[model samples]
Target: MTRSPTQTGRRAFLAGGAALLATPALAQTTNYTTPFENSTVVERDPSEVVRRNISSFRSLDWRPYFSDTRNGAVLVDTTSRALHFWSGDQSVYKLYPTSVPLTEELTRLGRTEIVRKVVGPEWRPTPSMKERNPEWPDYVGPGPDNPLGTHALYLSWTYYRIHGTHDTRKIGRKSSNGCIGLYNEHIAELFGLTNVGTQVLLI
Candidate 1:
């Protein structure tokens, strides 16, 4: 199958990044910590920032949101940079730039229902990751301060995940330790709707 210029571009970028990751120079990985972690990634007045970030991604209200009627599924139109949630055959929610550049595969960011949802999650630091950041906390229960957030939809192939963040500002920007983060509020909603076996594609 023929790939588009955009696909080729993204692929080249990822390949280059992977090469960098494999480099002996960058092979020295470091444990990532946020202001939230020292403070447990939590603070007062989360709603104000959460509410604002929600609007920043797309100028629509997320609460009474709409999704598609497409088999309780999601179609992340990477080309359009939009995230469409379908309930059946109709859309109940459509969020845009609610998006980021897809770096891994499948040309997108968000996970599906199967691989996207987990409860009472643990933060098992990977061998490589731990080697880099020996200070990273061991696996802990799901909560506001937990690195996994209240709920997590782990990516199938690796330790990477599409999880929640206390740092709401990270949403529109491409800032993360390789995971895709949503505000705590949005993730809470996802927790209620998604399941453990949900499939998450990153094209």
Candidate 2:
């Protein structure tokens, strides 16, 4: 059967993820982030600050990743902070710079699936999450500064989401509290294509 765009993305991601798994001998298994400059993987703590400025930011973007429409299923490797939308032959990848919680909770739930999608997602901050530094802006409008922009794909693994960030400058670097962030248009497009049962390779 001819696979859909999302399906193509999922296959490509799985292929890459499989290769990533098998190439432990060839590929560098111990990847490090400047965000974790002085920290140890074993010492990851959500409370521990691994990235800076992300403590408070002004704008976010999602237009880049959603440049094209999704086919059917997509592969999003959170550990690598990359999103892959596979089209049968060629594949598109977008890197999202985010700081994951340096904690067992996140590590233990790595490489999981992305179950659902949302557009112009609403925000609901936890009391504790809000207490941790408290600079996260209250619900804001989409485009250039909205924390949750045009779309947000929710991960069933945890309350975390692969969402569009108002802060696009942070892409390709570590800077989230354990969520996959994207830019407005990018995620908006992905959200439109993504559906239930779509695979999300967290890495």
Candidate 3:
């Protein structure tokens, strides 16, 4: 099925990514105004930040990134702070703004696949996370305050996941510790689309 471009300037923005930022049509429609920067310091509270990252949200063909969309494919572009998904049959495609790792040291790249799916997922800070923030709670059950929001898709890599975040401001920013984060509604849609063994790649 052909996808309808309901939002004005979205087609142009997706077609060219950063290159289209200069166009007046897209500039007027887009809300990204923050300058992009690499920082070593973690954003403890992203909501307090006045500016957000100007992510290069773009649509991508899956062929170049994945050999095949076997059980479907998910590609997370750390530099662009965007995630791309394609169905196995090549009938569906989706692009979403994402929150990536805070720093280069925290980022992981390469191939991985979804091994599990969970609804109302619990949260546990990793050992390293705990070491860094000792005051953080050891565990958190699912709720509005939970870091991992409504749904989570577990990846083959340990302590890594493509999950939803309650914090909407984090999207389109370098706000995640390690995992790729999506808006709750977006993750809910993705959760229904993806299944176990769905191929994933982070770049």
Candidate 4:
């Protein structure tokens, strides 16, 4: 019987331990722009930021220890601010930079499954988020400035999402309020490939 990508990827994760791969420099370039491409609130170039941080972006083949039996899990590493998707093949995995909330709670760290996928997602700041920042809007319509970017992969666990960001500079950094953030373009591509019921492991 052929092993599923989930099975192989899970096995890798269990056996590989938590040692993450080194992020290599990215040589690719694109005409990237902030998610706020249409907004005039603040104009800034994102391609330049990407050029500066290019050295910190990377995607690696998931090691055997990072494998998943489901063959369709989205593995996230808070320490590295990186997310991986096992392509049902041990030799192939897609990687993207991400931002995870900075915390030290072991119980908060674990695996969950993707329960839904939202395109052009709206933003409703949580009570906790509002409390921390009183000026936060009650709701933000989907657009360039929306924190959820163009797509959001809603996790089974409440109050968390693998979504897009307006700030490209935050990628590969531990700078979220307890959610995973990806670049708008990156999340758009990821959303197309991901599906509901995909496993999400945050370690």
Candidate 5:
């Protein structure tokens, strides 16, 4: 299929194999401890400045269990910090930890689907993010240091994503604005294994 210029550009950018896990120098210095404190002290690794903000990813109970859905489904258990990909078989699945919280507004429980998939996706800071950091760049080109990592599965929801992150340490916590964050390697694998329109269930 002939992709539009934007898609073509994205594909080309992704084809370059961007890193996706490096923090922008500006982001590295902003302190997340007091998000709205108006402090410009420039703390190191601000996004990952604190691990206690949410549950640790390592503490989650991850194991194979039965799901009646026999076709396929992407199961996200925020409470357990795990994302399970069920392969239409009750017995087969690949489990990865949930790296971000299900923000109340972004939660679309029940059923949804993957609307789109892109490799080396660009990073566009949300409005709230801009409010927090006015100095943030309007757009981050696709590359290794891009916040979206190496791949992204855009959900049916207006502003939700299952994508990779620059900071792996933020995994299994309430970090992202509302999207599901995954390690760069894990997302690359998931991106290869799934297709558009795959079922996604957040609970």
Candidate 6:
């Protein structure tokens, strides 16, 4: 049978659409590599992993979260998995992705101030962390292996910090024990901008 070119093209397009409709959608997978030495890589389905970047990552006003940007103000929005920083003079502002605590039980929400800032920060597993994972190292000096990365801002609350992570994958995920984690570069910049006595609020 002879068919017009237009008829042939229409048939071909319908066939392609049918093929696409028959194919199942592939689930997205992510490979997570732990920072610990000799740790095995694990593949996780999107649903299995902690939700990240789910909330709006837009710039926020400091007035809503802080009374004033005195000595600089840092606001960690656990729901959004983001960190917002406003300079003391309100000249410099930054927004960065962050990793929050693993679970609600580990999460602390309230006001705290930066009591100290350390470069090349050493790390020691908290007593509770040690009890939970005895296999973890007793101490890790400042280096690539150090989970605290290159810099750390110690908060007034004990065992809590706003620090950098050697594991980049941890950022924008709920992967920390009881701290907020940022990319090393972001933390270095933040470290330089902030100082002791910077007001921090985690909400």
Worst 10 residues of 5 by lDDT: 23-32
For model 3, residues 94-196, the per-residue Cα lDDT tens digits are 7777888888999999999999999999888899987987777888888887888899999999999999887666676678779898888889988998999
Candidate 6 global lDDT: 0.79
CA shift at 203, candidate 5, in angstroms?
Answer: 1.1
lDDT of 5 by residue, 1-203 (tens): 88899999988766543323222110111112311122122223544333232232232222333345444577787766667775554344566765655366644556688899999797777797689678877888787667777889999887778998766655655666677878788788778767787788787
Q: Can you write out model 2's per-residue Cα lDDT over 1-203, one digit (the tens) per residue?
A: 88899999989987876653332112111122321122113233423323332222212122333343334334454445455544322233333333344443534344444677766567655565567636655455544445665677788766678786664444444555566656566676566556665555554
Give one digit per residue, the lDDT tens place, for model 1 in 48-132: 2222232223323222432432335444433333343433433344342332332443233544445545665666766755575
Candidate 6 lDDT, 53-106, residue by residue in tens: 443766788899888888999999998788888888887888888878878998
Using TM-score as the measure, the top candidate is: 6
How far in Å is the alpha carbon of 178 misplaced in model 3? 0.2
Taken over the whole model, the C-alpha lDDT of each candidate is: 0.47, 0.50, 0.76, 0.65, 0.63, 0.79
Clashes of each: 33, 29, 0, 23, 7, 0
Q: How many backbone clashes does candidate 1 have?
A: 33
- The candidate that wins on lDDT is 6
Candidate 4: residue 12 lDDT (0-100)? 88
- The TM-scores, one per candidate, come to 0.51, 0.50, 0.76, 0.67, 0.63, 0.77
- Look at candidate 2 and tell me the lDDT of residue 203: 49
The residue pairs that clash in candidate 5, if any, are: 18-144, 19-144, 20-144, 21-166, 71-88, 81-98, 99-172
Q: What lDDT would candidate 3 get against the real structure?
A: 0.76
Cα RMSDs of all predictions? 16.6, 17.4, 11.3, 15.4, 16.8, 10.5
